[model samples]
Target: MNNKLSLKNINVKYGESLALKSINLDIYKGEFVVLLGSSGAGKSTLLRTINQLNPLTSGELDFFDLGKIRNKKDLQNLRKKTGMIFQQHQLIERNTVFQNVLTGRLGFHSLLRSILPLPKFDQELALDCIDRVNLLDKALVKVKELSGGQQQRVGIARALAQNPSLILADEPIASLDPKTSHQVLSMLKDICKKDNISALTSLHQVDFAKEYGDRIIGLSHGKIVFNGKSDQLSDEILKNIYSSSTITEETNFTSNEVVMV
Candidate 1:
């Protein structure tokens, strides 16, 4: 199968520290892949690397049909083709849910168009995305008025409004309760399946990843320790991924990640 995003020997460094080491990954259309690892294992770096939010130290990157992104237009096109969901809701607390969702379309708008009011069709698209996340009831309400889970739903809707073919989510549910986390992740996976959008999500909960992902990629010490189907994950494999054992350190790290590659 042709991949939507391909990375070859990808490496990322934060100052002198290596965040990602010699990573090779390929994601097919509509696959929900989970990334698993303790904090500092480079899950965040991997996700950021996909959208060029984190520059590669050295590597080849490609988006299907778009080829290697070597120019500004290519990079801009990449951004427009991919969506992002942050760990926190990252919504403008004062903005209404619908308004926040509209921000997702700014990449496609001219500067003047962005500053001016959005067109009627764009407004309708934002409303549809909001409805996709079951947030239509809160469309006119300020983001601050919603619960934590609701705010995260708004974030998802914002990404949907971008109409992206790929989504990069960095531990998007790290702050929610167990029930809420499951609900949010389920909604995200369902949307991806329905839209045939490839999703690369970093998550902390192993069980949740198993339930939602078509495949799982586990990292340790900034290197891939395991990459296979979710059902293929064994405790021994997780042990290898989490590494030579640092319990307290792992406790401080983030959530699970699943991807279909």
Candidate 2:
């Protein structure tokens, strides 16, 4: 299978903190990989690096046709090839869902074209993306007026608008309730499958990870403790992935602080 992404000797640092330590990984096309770790195991940092949002102290990333990062222009285009879903649904709350989804196409247009109203076909495309997330009816609604779950769905639509081959979701369902979390993740996986988009989603909910992911990577203090099929992530393996020195499986699920756990 074609690799969706590949990293070799990857390392990231923020001042004195070592966020990633010589991490290496390869994700195959159309596969869903779940990233799990305690509060500081570097899940978010790794995702940020994939999009060139976080500076890598040392590493080489190969994102298929996007190529290696050598300059600002290269990184900018690389971002266009990938979509990111953040914990906070980072939307223009005041804008209607259609406008927000249209933002995904900005990378494909010039600054002037981006700021101006999108063409009719673009509007129809945005509506189609919204419909994929089951929010077609809410397309005209102002984003701020929507529920938290709906807002997150809009984020997914915006990412879809990018027409990205790979989607990196950082705690996409963290803020949602258990039932809603399942709904959101199921929708995410289903869309990726139908669209043939590969996804690397960070999640704390172990059961959800198993149910939704084709593979799992468990991290601890910027290092991978396990990288295998989700079924291989036994309770004992989970315990190792979230050791007390990092994050234990017993860590509070409600707290983002359990990032490494």
Candidate 3:
């Protein structure tokens, strides 16, 4: 199968500290892949490297039909085609839901054009995205007025407005309660399946990862220790992934600040 995103011998460094080491990963069309790891295990770093948010120390990134990401223009095109969902919801609290979602379409317009009123098509698309997440009624409401789950749904709609071929969700549900997390993940998975968009999501909850992920990847100290179907993620592997970290079988932990890739 053709990959939506491919990373080969990827490495990322923050100054002298290495965050990702010779990592290799691939995401295919419509695939829902969950990333599991303890804090500082490199899940976030790996995701950021794919869209060039974290500059690679050495590696090659190939995006669907876009060839290798080797230059500034390639990076720009990659960003336009990719959608990102963050843990904090990342919405403008003062802006209406529709307004926040509309920002996703700005990538397609020139800088000057983005500042002006968006075309009718973009406006309609933003509404459609809101509807996709069952937030049509909340479109006119300020983002701050919504519940945590609703705010995350708005974030999903914003990403959907990009009409992306691939989505990268970095701990998208870390802040919500268990019930709300389930609702958000269910909505996100259903939407991606229906749209046939590939997704890579990071999570601390093992149960949720097993439930929602078609495939699961385990990260340990900046390296991938396991990558397989969810059913194949045995307990032995889980121990190896979180052994030295604070994460436990029953614990759902959260850490780190997130950014769009």
**TM-scores for every candidate against the unseen true structure:** 0.92, 0.92, 0.93
Give the winner by TM-score: 3
The lDDT leader among the candidates is 3
The alpha-carbon RMSD values of the candidates against the true structure, listed in the order shown, are 4.2, 2.9, 4.3
lDDT of 2 by residue, 92-175 (tens): 999999989999888888898888888887788888999999999998999999988999999999999888889999999988
Can you rank all candidates by TM-score, best first?
3, 1, 2
C-alpha local distance difference test of each model = 0.87, 0.85, 0.88
Kindly give the stretch of ten consecutive residues in candidate 2 with the minimal lDDT sum.
252-261
* Model 3 agreement with the true structure over 1-261: per-residue lDDT tens digits: 345688999989888988998899888889999999878899999888888888899989999888888899999999988899999988899999999999999999999999899999999999999999999998999999999999999989998999998889999989998888999999999999999999999998888898899999999889999999878877678777876565445543222221111
> Candidate 1 — what's its lDDT?
0.87
lDDT per residue for candidate 1 within 1-261, as digits (tens), equals: 355688999888889988888999888889999998877788988988888889889998888668898878998998998899999878999989999999999999999889999999889999999999998999999999999999999999999989898988998998998899989999999999999999999987888888888999999988989999988887668767877455432342224432211
